[model samples]
Target: MLSLTDVDKVYLTENEAVQAVSSINLTVENGEFVSFIGPSGCGKTTVLSLIAGLFNPTSGKILMDNKEITGPTEKTGYMLQEDYLFPWLTIQKNIELGLIITNLYNEQTKKDAMTLLSDLGLDDKANAFPSELSGGMRQRAALVRMLAPKPSLLLLDEPFSALDYQTKLKLEDLVFSTLKQQNKTAILVTHDLSEAIAMSDRIFLFSSRPGTIYRVFDVPAEFKDKLPLEVRNDPNFHLFFQTVWKELEKVENQNSNTS
Candidate 1:
């Protein structure tokens, strides 16, 4: 399980100090998927970074399975909007990179990574370089690399934002199913509301600047078992989207007023 208690973060620059997030308290159960959404500059990514242990919180604490997260650990993996795969490396090398860095490399780890590549339909591209694959395929390769280490918690920072609409939808289903099958806990920071509603067990909505949890929307139980694409087609999807949309609009409007 992952827990954040009254977490606050402050950034200092030559000019002044900025509070990015404040009073954040939440918990994510094992194998649960959660998404954070709000207007730009609401510190959604800051919260994710704190969870990833990229930096420590200025106040309070973040714990994973009762242990504090002081720095990046092997228990968590991060994926971003860009694939960040090395251009000179073949897909196979890219996939094995994480395992090598974490001292997890071995014949068995290689086999498992290859199996995941095959599962994502990238087995044939093992010998290919990043430039040889499409954006979507490279992202899939990146996913394989991230999963190769078998991290229990995955931090996804708009991993699908750069893909085309169709590719985004397809990848969403693939990722949702893959994580569920592996029983991985994931925290996604996305600007897309429909994407959030479709892929998340719960959505954390944040207030404007110096972000705080504005609300938490629990996905309907009926949609839990459905893939993201199927969730979009469900009648209940729009109902829930509208509910979150109204709240998000309020957040955006508040930001405008304060600005």
Candidate 2:
């Protein structure tokens, strides 16, 4: 449903232009969950911003649902490192933020927010403020808010990094299932190789800064049907993890030597 062709991004300072990504060509199929894994300073997040139309690309193009992306569209939902919940607003109101922004807010939209909270077991906390809930609950509430608008594509940017390990793992399943149930396409950018391996149908490995596609690995057929935790516990988990880890190490080392 989304594709990037020969994409490149550059940032200009007073002195010189810095290239962030180079020739990033990618395609994410409808309802597919894809993850981008790379070292720090790589252009993974840049690619997401391009897809989200947060800014224009320096070269090449990004297409969504067969249309070229020009600017941010309501069909995409973004979840970042922090929940970004409004402390003054109740969870229910926060969940409806997208609807309100789109001028789509109405009684049914409010009910839909509540329904999402209820389904996610956050209904009990719907009336609570952000400061009143634990981090995990707040993040779950954030997910409800992101999903409230029924976006077709979800862009996740290391969203679980601040959470504890158990909570992170739990939310992984929650997010994976939620997207599947809603039939939403997703693109995740993460430094966590294991997280990417466990959650993605396919993982896109990127090179160091001025990032380009290094390799695209499809999860083994046997593990494709498994959930995150199940995949994590499987024997091949180590193998997949180690393979990516070694690849990342190689990328880093090669860059270091060249630089």
Q: Which candidate achieves the best lDDT against the true structure? A: 1
TM-score of 1: 0.99
Tens digit per residue, CA lDDT, model 1, 155-181: 999999999999999999999999999
lDDT for 232 (candidate 2): 92
lDDT of each: 0.95, 0.88
TM-scores, all models, native as reference: 0.99, 0.97
- Candidate 2 lDDT at 14 equals 100
Which window of ten consecutive residues has the lowest lDDT sum in model 1?
Answer: 235-244
TM-score for predicted model 2 compared with the true structure: 0.97
Residue-level lDDT of model 2, residues 52-73, one tens digit each, is 8899999998999899999987
Model 2 CA deviation exceeding 4 Å by range:
none
Query: What RMSD does each model have against the real structure?
Result: 0.7, 1.1
In candidate 2, the residue pairs with backbone N, CA or C atoms under 3 Å apart (3 or more residues apart, or in different chains) clash, namely none
Which of the numbered candidates is closest to the native, going by highest TM-score?
1
